[model samples]
Target: MEWSRRNIWCVILLTCLVFWVMLLVGLNAVA
Candidate 1:
């Protein structure tokens, strides 16, 4: 699959969102 500009952006945004969600959940669990 070709990594078009839109596709790359989508993957980056999705990764960022997933990372943020996991970080928040981890902090909540620790606290």
Candidate 2:
């Protein structure tokens, strides 16, 4: 149970990072 919780958080963090990267890339392309 503990390990699963940690994994979930890791996945969430990674997803957020990826989303932020994509947003930056999109903004750069627009500019």
Candidate 3:
């Protein structure tokens, strides 16, 4: 159960990181 929870958090963090990177890239392109 603990492992599953940890895995879910890791995936969420990774997804958020990717989203941030994309947002930065989009802003940079706009400016």
Candidate 4:
């Protein structure tokens, strides 16, 4: 159970990182 919880957290963090990267790229493209 602990392992599963940790895995979920890692996935969430990775997704968030990807989202921020995409947002930055889009803003740069616009400017």
Candidate 5:
């Protein structure tokens, strides 16, 4: 159960990182 919880957090963090990168790219494109 602990391992599963940690894995979920890892996935969330990776998703957030990808989202931020995409957001930055979109802003750069607009600018």
Candidate 6:
């Protein structure tokens, strides 16, 4: 159970990072 919780957090963090990177790239392209 503990391991599963940690794994979920890692996935969430990775997802957020990917989203942020994509957003920055999009904004830069627009400008």
Best by TM-score: 2
Residues 1-31 of candidate 5: C-alpha lDDT, one tens digit per residue:
9999999999999999999999999999999
Pairs in clash, predicted candidate 5: none
Cand. 1 TM to true fold? 0.88
Where does the lowest 10-residue lDDT sum fall in candidate 1?
A: 1-10
Candidate 1 residue runs with Cα over 4 Å from true position:
1-3
How do the predictions measure up, each by TM-score? 0.88, 0.95, 0.90, 0.93, 0.90, 0.93
Q: For residues 1-31, what per-residue lDDT tens digits would candidate 1 score against the true structure?
A: 5669889999999999999999999999999
lDDT by residue for model 4 (1-31), tens: 9999999999999999999999999999999
Each model's lDDT comes to 0.95, 1.00, 1.00, 1.00, 1.00, 1.00
- Cα lDDT, model 5, residue 11: 100
- Screening candidate 2 with a backbone cut-off below 3 angstroms (N, C-alpha, C), the clashing residue pairs are none
Off by over 4 Å in 3: none
RMSD of each: 2.7, 0.3, 0.4, 0.4, 0.5, 0.4
lDDT of 2 by residue, 1-31 (tens): 9999999999999999999999999999999
Error of 3 at 14 (Å): 0.4
Q: RMSD in angstroms, candidate 6?
A: 0.4
lDDT of 3 by residue, 1-31 (tens): 9999999999999999999999999999999
Candidate 6 residue-wise lDDT, 1-31, digit = tens:
9999999999999999999999999999999
Clashing pairs in 3: none
**For model 3, what is the error of residue 2's alpha carbon versus the real structure, in angstroms, after optimal superposition?**
0.8
